[model samples]
Target: MRKLILLITLTLSGTLAVGQTTQKPPLHGKHWMAITGKPLAATAGSMIFNKGGNAVDAACGILAANCTMWDVLSWGGETQALIYNPKTKKVIAINAMGVAPTGATPEFFKEKDMAYPPEFGPLAATTPGTPGGLMTMLAEYGTLSLAEVLAPAMEMAKGYPIEAQTATIIENQKHLIKEWPYSKKVFLPHLGEEREAPYPGEVFVQEDLFQTLKKLVDAEKEALAQGKNRKEAIYAAYARFYTGDIAEEIVRGTREQGGLFTMEDLAKWKVKIEEPLQVNYRGIDVYKLQEWTQGPAMLQSLNILENFDLKSMGYNSANYIHTVYQAMNLAFADRDFYYGDPAFEPKSPMKGLLSKEYARERAKLIKPINDPEIGPGDPYPFQGEKNPFLHLLEKQNEVIAYNNHGTAILGPDDPFLESFLAGTTSIQTADAEGWVVSVTPSGGWVPATIAGNTGVGLSQRMQSFVLDEKLNPFNVLEPGKRPRVTLTPSMALKDGKPYFSFAVQAGDTQDQNLLQMFLNVVEFDMTVQEAAEAANFNSYQMQSSFGAHESKPGAITLNTQIPSWIRGDLKKRGYKMDFLERTSGPLNAIWFDWKHGTFWGGSSNHGEDYGIAW
Candidate 1:
């Protein structure tokens, strides 16, 4: 009995010691880190880094795993990014946004009088650019074989335990899953009287996805040899999955359900890469994906912030938050009014959207505590400078409310209605250890009830559009046109050296969230972990807490940690208010500890994702 008791005590001590070591005293190495919205996705990226892959390779691995983990953001969806090449001291933009099908047009939608069918599912789908995007990056910069890089994802899809966050996502978005049989199978297999996720510790498999990737690897060498038609071996494989066999299955299933996707669309689709938008912020150059997303708008906001004394205002204080939101509203107003893809309009305003003079003009409209209603400002004219070449309009118009019925402002209905009306933003970041940022690509809360010509439901990409008379809304849905997105994947450079890479998910709120977070680090001088974990407000026009987009009433969100004194002071100044118990945006980030040559990364616990490094 004495010997047995001693043995039991020894076993308990051993377990405790193991747990202590597992806590990990911060990893040290030259690593390529990936910070994404999911733990499994991050794990896949870290594995690639461990296997001698670069940031690009890690990103591909993460993208694949993310598709299986969260259907809303990957697989046949758009992907845009900013990649930094330390060797050349240049940042490359991988613009994998889908192009408008040659068949899309504004007139087409107007003819139908349907407020641009929310483009989600098959008919609204653009040729998925991920294949081309990943391939292009691999062909240019990757050292690992594509087959090797893709292995982790194949393994993940075949079967892995579902994480707590992913399960919560499944529960929250059950409606989207119930719409289609395949979606339901992957999301919630019917379990005796009700649907439930594959239990934790149970192997979850995506046979179709796994089979599809295997086919790609088996034929990659042959596919590369021929431009149009690859070597027969690879060509046959790609056709069987993408066009011939698997394509037929997708088409048949879609048709039975009522979708507009056809095998021809998949066969004819190709990825398009365009010039990235560039801007200057306080002598530092910034780059982002073009107008199809709100990338340029982030550049514009930074440009405006450069004209202000953010560091002096203090971090997360009402004063600082006010300035940030004002800048965001001004930029977003321009976004709603002018931003869009250049190929369609040929005269889009994105080119001059981030001009220093333009930012200056936009900054002039902001009064310290005046609390002007939301729509009473414009960026171009506020800069206090005039353009000689272009005829600029001087407008400070107050917009009418969406309905003017004075909707009830109290009770559960109010919050529920507001939450329903807002959109979600995703964040991605890359570190000096090769971490990167890719906030998920879609826009707002889509109407799940509306089915596309393809039996699949539409995503809320239409919320990106705003009805503006003078400048064509950049977010308008044209069949072949990519909508203007707000996914801002960014890299920070200090003294021309790459400092960090970060991205957030929050639709139009992306720039605002990023701006506050960056200030939390650069201005407030907080530690990387603190900057990543700190609660911040996004002053963009999405959440009803900021009043209506049309109202444009100035407001600021306060992290609960903020002192009540600061909140009361801001309220006295007439700033409208909302207090978030949790940080509103999901931030994934990585910083290169230049001093130690190590990477420290964190994925926000506020969101269900995990941050990973090797």
Candidate 2:
């Protein structure tokens, strides 16, 4: 409904001479932008854009560079992306997430004397989806070849100076790295020398990783030389990783290490391009990856919040935070209960969960004070069926005792409990021609063993799956079933035109942080930078989507900048509040103002995030 106005008014009087006047209008230009949680990745994407490539090309480059940030991203991890093409006026979602091995089963883990798959070994690894995902994007929507975009990342793998955060992460995981020979060989110092973590200025190199990437580039070259077109060459590169020697090495190493990945699994895995799930918030259309990820949680929360006047509630106020927390809790409740890979579902539940009427009905259950246990809604009523998980949902109300491995004691003193949170990196790119992309590439984090000498590590994503046999229909272990990943990227359009692209890199806190940033822009009318910098809070009132699926009812953590009075008000309203030195997640955003012909971008300054506009 808001439109940019451009006009000049002039008045003439009964004088001998006439004067003309004009009003200054907002300046506009074609904008090229890129933002990421790391400076090098942002620079890499900008380089691609500067070289006359579109957003898809820049996105490929950015994702490749992100692999170097081993502290926050994984070289052999999974990726999910949303790309908007101005040419076709269509938005596409890429589900490049990893899947469970055919041999993975609860019975297998139980037989091995484990309650669940070990989180740091070969048994925890899944078939990586990044290579296929990136190549598919290049083949379909990208302007440059894979080798061209990946050149910067290959150089980074050859050698680069370590950063402070990465240094700290490596130091913390040193003990775990020592557990695996290949991991120690690649990440730790030599066995006989004084084992020390790489310092901030110290050069860190991964020659093996460099060679692995070069192999893919060589495959592309070979294809090109064989008279194949660019798309075919890209596929050749993908095959090199998924169906060639790389796949063979992964399968062999996984089997040797007592894992279950097979050549057939690798051959069958491919990135799927599907339509993004969307919801209308105000006049804007927000898009996210489907239920396989936690992306729809943001949309569901928005749909619930759309019932209230967020602007009147005031930003970050007790009422505002409480309202958002309540909505988020409800949405997450549904996320935990119903979200899964649609390929495995008997029927799609998204149509019911995304229905505005369903959101309104769910929102009516929100209380001024946090509900002790707000379970998933009966979305199936809209689908004309009884809720299938009603019994399990009711059972979740009873808190289960957690067996802390390191500390038997409960409370803040438990070392195992305190070390639960983690972070990731996000990248967003948009070219002047209006091709936009938002990607969250993650997995293969530390404590996980590298796949033999291939330089590619396996993702521990299988840990996100529920081991309970009763929950098998949703989020349970199954061959080729995608994990219910917390990685979510977002895009929005105003008046059916591309408006902004955004994503954050925190586990369960991702959608929470994204919702806050988005509302800051649409409701509080903050600039992209101001919105990203604003104080934020995360609610842990529902079960986490990670290991053990812990839930802390009525728990909320806010940035220290939030006023004490607001914190006290929330406490008075029956909420437990905690404060962190800074916000939980690192966020990145790129906004395009079509009417003004301008692009604006922002990245969190709290971490190594960088935003570049040209």
Candidate 3:
């Protein structure tokens, strides 16, 4: 280790990374840019933009289309987004995350002999959030009608070529799909055959889902015929989904599937548009959705990271990785314990958690070695208030560990790790009119239980809740309380102008990969595409927000391309090193070349993510 440090000292060039050449060419656009988790989805956004819609409208199009294609998500999931409305000249956050339905208390799960909520099934669902989210964004900020934005998705629902990835997932999880009658009907078109699921490139048709969408469009058309304006017409459609026959079907279908969703749960749950949380790092303002979605953890990391000279350590160096890893663990420790829906009592110590002085205190705790004992710190004291859960908080730290989440020999398919990196998709859109949007929408992937004939997939986000206050006092499951989620969308502004918009699809690793990608651009001079393809590392030391909520302290994962000596050095520092061929994101991003007055889009080369700029 000493020899490696001396080597790093002597060969700073080796430690510091240089600019990287990328496999895919950078995307350049002037009129608009659309990038997402799928090619057809990006085209959906482009189509809306071509129809003279702004970024928010195009983003809704991309989001709805991805759900229709089951790009690891569906309409009955959740949507968390940060939009930079040029009209307001400020970033706005949409809280479309669903809450637990009635009778979904901690005691209910404990009585079932479960540690947490089930990962799949109707019992796992929260009230649907995506449809309300899409309509809210379109109605409030977008110029186009709901029918206009949903056209592409409705078309795909009628019949679109199913991709290999989604089709294989259906085939692999056929048994689970068969359990849900509606899902069995929609997903197993060739049931009892050798291949139960649809084939890749096969024209898959979702008549029920198509009908569901048509009903919403029909509602809009009826409202317009009655002389309602565009926004009012959109809300009329929204009301029909949440309060009319659609909500009735959702409730009836969910109840029949052994789920719990009431008309009240669907109607009472409304989309919230609020100012997002922000923290400035070196004069650049980074914005994210609030604590409800684990977004503030990234802001906290940036606060602590502001105290370090990451550029001097070289990108992804042992020192850099360890520092960032420790910082993420620190922020996530707080996330596990304090982050929950702020609407409830005993709110998170946002005033203290994001405090620069508190960050300095947390930063001071980082040692040369990984600290397995590192856990949640007292942000309440920093904020000058008595902690409401101080007694529980002490025990919470000790309990924030797992005996075995992932083994050194375990494959990526290990249940814990796979769940840790599970579902969702991201959408990024920008227009010449100055509208910008970033969205991370997730839940209800394949093998999902379709709620009745509503053709909506139920969200499995209820698993994100804790059954014990000792685990997370704020996030303990309760009726009508939103679960603390891992989905986060990110954006940054520099000199009061949109700098970049970025987000990814994953569970616990969403912010981890996003933090590294942001640093790849801000700290290193990597272009957006280079950053997207860069070899990144992961620290499994923090408590995961997905299934099992496991934590494996001192565990670090890296790409095979990392230098052997750096890997050895990290191992010497007590990191249980895991290697993979690709560890970075499927990160999707857009960099604004403010001086040139254009957009530079980066779609990750690691996944099926694609982008178009024109």
Candidate 4:
């Protein structure tokens, strides 16, 4: 261990700080920074930064480690990232999410007399897209050789012990891991026995995964040859994984175990890089993953919040949380009803249903204080530049406006909206002063499959359908359709400079965590760690296929710290409350360097991660 540390320090040309722990310092000043869900992964990103890689390069590095050290939560899944080039002042998004097979239909399950399996199933599985997306980013933006970028992950895979977080996930999802022989082969030794804790610091190796990576890495040069598209080479690697002997064996194994993913499906699969959903919040442009997930819903929530007085409401107070809950409900109601792959018929009240002008009108319906009689928002609005939706908010102002307190009141029509509150948020603040927010819902396709051979546990992401039963435009389930993901990665810019980048990883809890973090930083001026450690809440006031553990219609769940007295008062206001122990979302962030051109970055001690620097 000491030798490895010396080698790393020497490689990066840095002196060891006295009494420095195993973790590296946050990259300060014009240097690059990278963070991830795991310490090793973050270290991988840091290594890339030290090797003259930029944010994109560091991202690739972290991704590599995610596949290795954080396999359970990382790869063999979807990926989405938001990137900004400070040099060019341009922001771009990458949506490399897996998609359902073209031949897949919800009715297929019905025909099989099968419930849409929760995690792994033909329907739950989509063609994996992360590998392709990584290749795309590397080809388009990365400066390091593929070999260099992947080296850290390979080493991590071959050396060291299992991380605590990875062990926990392994234990939590033991059913899924133990069911497959291949999976058990990789993780069981560490666990010692079924349901046992993975011994901390125990060395683990993913020999198969390493070989797969090596295979792809070995093809890089041949792939880059003239007249041969680099993207095609990348796709070929996946093809081999899914359609060749590897995929055939997976399908055969899963089929023998009664799983339904087909080789034809894998062979025809492709990763699509779709355009991100765009919105304007406070004149600042924001992009989300579209209808396949909570990306657009998050934007809608922001839009609704714009109509409220959050700045004056005071952060995390009962009143503040109540208002945000209402906003989220209103936004997500539309999401559940209208979002799906746009290539298929999708329904959205906000789709020409509400224009920017109409959104302004809808904003007027919200009140400052709790509204016991929240009304159902209009599903249809008058069309065109001059739409009747614009007039709706104008008409009802007199009856609801609070004469004494200047707040909006709930009306009869409010019952159309469900009342629950919950979501998670994650933020990454890097040494380069790069800030991002990534929030995703947990209820998407995950966990289940009919005990399979290939060992790929599929997801039920198809539930994110539009009202007309079509997939959301951004979430179409074509060969390459990225699942409609709720993951929203956000960055805040102040005075034409990057201030913060925050991303949340919780499936549904993303929204709540993000709202709190923003308040902590922008309103309360709390440091990143404080915001992450603070108790949080979740509200589910919308009709969502995504189920909440604690939320019920017209109700919410708060961390136990929420005063019990507040719960009684909230119930009286028609809000149901469930107090919980430890309802937290990992909130990772990097505060930008305002002086000396260095960035300050950190991860939530709330999570099993560390910050890395170059």
Global lDDT of each model? 0.57, 0.79, 0.90, 0.56
Tens-digit lDDT track of model 2 for 1-614: 12211122222332222331111111123667878877788889888888878889998888888876574666678999999988899999998998988889878887878755666788887788888889999899998988889988888888888788777777778888777777778787545556456777678888878888899999999999999999999899899898999888878877887789988998898789999999999999999999989899999999999999989989888899989999998998888777888888644488889989899999899887767567777788876667776677655544322211122222444332343355667888887788889998888877667777777877888877877734434777788988788899999998878887899887888899999999989999877767777788887765666665666667677888888898788888777666776773688887787667888777765677886677
Clashing pairs in 3: none
- Candidate 2 minimal-lDDT segment of 10 residues: 19-28
The model with the greater TM-score, 2 or 4, is 2
Q: Write model 1 residue lDDT over 1-614, tens digit each, in one string.
A: 99877777866776433232221122333555566766677788788778877777777777766655543454445566677765667777776665544444556546756444433343344545555466666556566666777788788767777666556666667766566566665556544445476555566766666776776776665565554332343344445545665566655665565555566766765545445677766555566777766666678778888888988877776777777777877776666556676667644555457677777777887776733444423333444444332332233232323322242222324433344324343434444534344435432122232221221222334333432333334455565556665556776766676665667765456667676667676678765556766787644243221122223244455667778888787777766566676664666666668788777664554665566655
lDDT for 86 (candidate 1): 59
What's the CA error at residue 244 for candidate 1, in Å? 5.6
- Ten-residue segment with the worst summed lDDT in candidate 3? 11-20
- Positional deviation of residue 220's Cα in model 1 after best superposition, in angstroms: 1.2
Instruction: Write down the TM-score of every candidate.
Output: 0.80, 0.91, 0.96, 0.77
State the TM-score for model 4: 0.77
Instruction: Give the distance in Å from residue 80's predicted Cα in candidate 4 to where it truly belongs.
Output: 1.1
lDDT of 4 by residue, 429-515 (tens): 243434332322122122334223333334445443321222122233344344455666766666666666776665555655666
Model 3 CA deviation exceeding 4 Å by range: 1-20, 401-410
**Order of the predicted models by TM-score, top scorer first:** 3, 2, 1, 4
lDDT (Cα) of model 1: 0.57
Taking the tens digit of each residue's C-alpha lDDT, what string does model 3 give over 1-614? 99777766855654433233676778999999999999999999999999999999999999999999999999999998999988879999999999999999878889999999998999999999999999999999999998899999999999999999999999999989999999999999999999999999999999999999999999999999999999999999999999999999999999998998999999899999988999999999999988888999999999999999999999989999999999998998899888998999768889999999999999998899888768888988788998888898778755854444345344567676787778588999999999999999998998798999988998999999999888888888889999999999999999999998999877888899999999999999899988988898877767777777777777777899999999888988888877888888789999999889999999877789999889
